[model samples]
Target: MIQRFIELGEGYGDIFEICELARTNADRLEQAFIMYANHNDKQVASLAISLKPVGDSKFMPIYLCREGIPYNAEKPSQRLAIFEEALAQLNVVPNRFEIKHSSIFSENNLYYQYLIGILRLNHYIPPMH
Candidate 1:
């Protein structure tokens, strides 16, 4: 089984795309996740949707809106609000995790690898076969 993160840019206009994907692929949708990380002293979030492999493709695509939305307690960002609304409409609750910033790694790919490890360790995703 192969699992990969398909980044759809930050939570700008791409957030709508994420919502659309979830709605369109409802059957394949496995779990929705909200990952919080500190980036440059700012609290940001990455919204992700894990999809089960389609048919026998063995490719599990994890759609993501990388760290962009400000995770403010006083007032949430529009992007975050939209994500919440979409999940509510679909009756899907996302699993949230607060993690260290991606900047801890020298490269972006390493950051993703770290995230994959964390998810696997927590049983959010299956381990390697």
Candidate 2:
């Protein structure tokens, strides 16, 4: 199966969209995640929404808000808090993972591929079929 990341923006704004998607497609929602990374000594996070494949379409789209929010572990932010609250309302706890910054990759697509590998390895998403 093919899995891909669809980048939104960052933080609560992205979370809002994710929440809406989850609420609308509650049946197909598989997992919600927050990808964290350190970029030039700054902590940031990306929101993700994973959906199950439909019919013959083997692609699983993981919607994301590319690294933008300050890591809550280092500093508290209202944006992060709002995202957490939204997830709570959806009854979907986020699966967090620390990862390398996208800036390190030559292309954004490559960065997404790297995240897909990590997610598969961690069993957050299914392996290729």
Model 2: per-residue Cα lDDT over 1-27, one tens digit each: 889877787756576787788778777
RMSD of each: 1.1, 1.7
Q: Write the residue-wise lDDT of candidate 1 on 1-129 in tens digits.
A: 678999998846799999999999888888899999988778999999999987788788889998878898689889998988998898999999898887788998998888889888888887777
Worst 10 residues of 2 by lDDT: 72-81
- List clash counts for every candidate, in order: 0, 1
TM-score of each: 0.94, 0.89
lDDT of 2 at 37: 90
- lDDT (C-alpha, whole model) for all candidates: 0.88, 0.83
lDDT of model 2 at residue 84? 74
lDDT of 1: 0.88
Error of 2 at 31 (Å): 0.9
